[model samples]
Target: MDASFVIHGPSIKPGTEIELISNTDVAPTAAQLLSVEMKNVDGRVLTKVMM
Candidate 1:
């Protein structure tokens, strides 16, 4: 069986769900949310979840 995952934070809206996300995308997503730029990341940011 596969494990389910969640990304929770104060800026994130409750009950939001996104599919087909890569584990490698987490870092880039966080960086973008914090107004930090990332270079040469393995995966792209999950922009759909952004406000």
Candidate 2:
């Protein structure tokens, strides 16, 4: 799979980087940032990027 990305957001720490095992993790990670719950999701929240 060709999986690579450069994500920038207010909650993301500057000059920080992380590796994700699956693209599915994106949805859960974004939900965490907004403090919302996503049903039927199997992805983990990306704690490393949270402010």
Tell me each candidate's TM-score. Answer: 0.70, 0.75
Error of 1 at 10 (Å): 4.2
lDDT of 2 at 16: 70
**Candidate 1 lDDT, 18-42, residue by residue in tens:** 8867778889989988989999889
Q: So what's the TM-score on candidate 1?
A: 0.70
Model 2 root-mean-square deviation: 1.6
The numbered model that scores best in TM-score is 2
Alpha carbon lDDT of each predicted model: 0.79, 0.80
**In model 1, how large is the Cα lDDT of residue 42?**
98
Could you give candidate 2's per-residue lDDT for residues 1-51 as a string of tens digits?
577766688888877788755788899988988889898998888788777
Global CA lDDT computed for model 2: 0.80
Off by over 4 Å in 1: none
Give the distance in Å from residue 5's predicted Cα in candidate 2 to where it truly belongs: 2.0
